[model samples]
Target: MPSHGAWLKVGGAMARVIHVFRHPDRFVSGTVGEPGERTFYLQASSESKQVSVTLEKQQLTVLSERLTSLLEEVASRFDTEVPPSAPEELTDTDPLDVPVEEEFRVGTMGLGWDAESSSVVIELLAITEGEVDENIVLDDTEEGPDAVRVFLSPAHARAFAERAERVINAGRKPCPLCDEPLDPEGHICPRQNGFLRDNPFTEG
Candidate 1:
């Protein structure tokens, strides 16, 4: 079993620490807290090692959308047989794993398809106060920010994206007129000149 954490050395100094899950048993996106106040997370586990990283809701949404698009491109360009949707049996709806201690806040994410393994590779780098090096986003460089790397099968990738979409939509209802999230009390629609309007789409 690989260590839960691995450190790299750069120029006689400690470099970034990376957690790599070559064949994760499970990987999914989840959240903690209520709809409007949710904190999104991406969790991956294999055997005894479980890692969770925090990201913005919009980031998760983009990741899900890009995963689908990447699969489509793979199928079209490489003649790969990618599933149109995740298999029902593999659908995961469980909450985030226990002890969801965030290792880091993700600042940069990288996604790619590994042809040799026929897997989707997702890399998440820790947020830095300064600008990030573009090469470190995906490359295995000794000097870079901490990162979590998970390689998923096409089926698992599809499942992850599907679950992510569901989690994102489970948030607060959006205002029909302005497309903004509606408060529990009601939404003041800017489009309607700050007038409070009842959202027909949301059930009372």
Candidate 2:
């Protein structure tokens, strides 16, 4: 997706805010597991606070793609080049760290850029249970919805954009016929009219 050339604000003010981390030094998405069992995570950190949230494969894919487009727009508008940086290759790597607890499953997301700070802002909104009260108002000092706000420098954002794409594409290979992920055991290819397809690339 191409950038909209404008930042879009998402979510309403009524939801209960959970956590917000601003100007985080680190924000990256990673996954754990084999093929179908993979669990995606979006982790962020600063000097004092750290946050990690679980997200679905689809959400991760969208976030990565949108960030890429947003960065492209910023580069064009500012006539600046976004340099390539390898975040995963950096040493002193902060471990996903304790309290890697899943704060909330991300349901929706928003992105923007702060020209003053030359940083990209990404917001992850929570998945709420039950119907939300549209009229609910949060106190000025109160944190709203189980959300996470992160600020990423252009270079870091570029790094994340690259890393996210890598993680997302590392999933199981898809069936050539149907374009659906192939299971390790076997798969009934829809294009083959339910013919069982064995893993030709792996030993049975």
Q: Assess each prediction's global lDDT (C-alpha) against the native.
A: 0.85, 0.67
For model 1, the run of ten residues with the poorest summed lDDT: 195-204
- Segments of candidate 2 deviating more than 4 angstroms: 1-15, 84-95, 129-144, 174-204
lDDT of 2 by residue, 1-204 (tens): 112111223454354444545556668887766665778889887777677889888788788888888888888898566765544554223435665778778866778787766788887767776543333221112333456777667778888787777677667677888977666678899899998998554311
**Top candidate, metric lDDT:** 1
Best by TM-score: 1
State model 1's lDDT: 0.85
Could you tell me the TM-score of candidate 1?
0.82
Question: Cα deviation in Å at residue 161, candidate 2?
Answer: 1.2
Q: Candidate 1 residues 1-204, lDDT tens each?
A: 133568878777887888989869899999998755788999999999999999998899899999999988888988567788999988998888899999999999999988888889899999999999887766777777899988888888999999998888777687878888675567799999999987544421
**Clash pairs of candidate 2?**
16-144, 16-145, 17-143, 17-144, 17-145, 18-144, 18-145
Error of 2 at 187 (Å): 15
| Cα lDDT, model 1, residue 87 | 94
Candidate 2 global TM-score: 0.65
Tally clashes: model 2.
Answer: 7
